[model samples]
Target: MRIVGISVLCLFCAFSAIVFFTYYRRNSATFSYDIVLPTIFGNSTEFNTSEIKKKRRAFVVNVFASWCTVCMQEHQTWKEISKRTPIDLYGIDYIDIEDNTLAWLQEPDNPYIAIAADYSGKAAKAFGLREYLKLLFSTKKVNWCSI
Candidate 1:
């Protein structure tokens, strides 16, 4: 009788822990962090990271590679999202050549509000990207004319 009671209590505790973890991981905003630079791309005269962040209420930083086929596939979805939504889009041109990135921007369906070149991968690394592949979200006022 004593051994059976102990087993039941352990089972109950295990189930409780699983439920708690599931709720926490799915709903918590642990992965979202404020980006340090606002407009990190293009000619300095055209866009500046610090300036854009100050002007826009919220923005998205997409970590992408020019050669990444998955990133390529996601481009259309991103384009649609940009056109339909009020959200500001920023690109972290992750680990790609300057010329290739330039050609990518020249694509018929350009969607980025601004592009930041991250050749050294330091910015993405600072965002602790390798820890996990998660999408970060934030909310801010929209300035539609800027786009």
Candidate 2:
């Protein structure tokens, strides 16, 4: 009975440690903007990384996929946001076809100022794309005009 209790206690401690470590590691990882994301459409255009970062206009780096229904749904909100504020909205199309991204943008309802195709997924990873989903989940209103 003593041996069983000790083993159970050890197991519990080990499990708790693992959970704590994972939670700490994920939360502790700071988000940075050192990444120079490549552009799919702006390749022929004159836009550069510094130009994007240094622009006085507020920028929203939206990482999305053409297949993602959420991205399509957010288009209207983005449009409204753009109109109400002096924002330079950029998009990183996470794993999408260039033609499709271009076609979708050409649709009368597009809102992005610049759209980049993240073919390798590196740019999305750099931008902490997953964390942005949490923003959408929250109830707080994100007002760019006030920012």
Candidate 3:
């Protein structure tokens, strides 16, 4: 009985530690603008956040995919919003075929001032993007703007 109790306690502690660390790592993960991916359209082959900041006081980095149904649904909204906001909006196409991304963007007004294709998946990893539609708003402070 004593052995069983000790084993159970050890298991509980181990499980607790894993849960804590997972939570901590996910929450503490930071997004960086150092990502460089192939440009699908607009601007250039490189994504320079600083250059965008120079054009606008702030900017929005949206992570999207060509196959995402929700992303397609929101594309029009983005086009409308971009037409109104002074802030420059950029796009990172999450793992998808480059041609598909371009086609999808061409269907709409293409809200993004610049869009990049994340062929290597490094851009998504660098952005700490967990979802297909996560938006990072850079103003006085960087904030995760999920819509």
Better of 1 and 3 by TM-score: 3
lDDT of 3 by residue, 102-142 (tens): 77777647788888878777777776766677887777454
lDDT winner between 2 and 3, please give it. 3
TM-score for each predicted model, relative to the true structure = 0.61, 0.63, 0.73
Cα lDDT of all candidates, in order? 0.66, 0.63, 0.77
lDDT-based ranking: 3, 1, 2
Which scores better on lDDT, 1 or 3?
A: 3
lDDT of 2 at 30: 57
Q: Give the lDDT of residue 36 in candidate 2.
A: 62
Worst 10 residues of 3 by lDDT: 138-147
lDDT tens string, model 2, 68-113? 7887788788889878877666777788888887777776746676
> What is the per-residue lDDT of model 1 for residues 18-132, given as tens digits with 9 covering 90 to 100?
9999987864444323444333454453434446667656667677877888888888999999899887877777767878877877877688877777677766665556732
Which one wins on lDDT?
3
- What's model 2's overall lDDT? 0.63
After superposing candidate 1, which stretches have Cα over 4 Å from the reference? Answer: 1-50, 131-134, 141-147
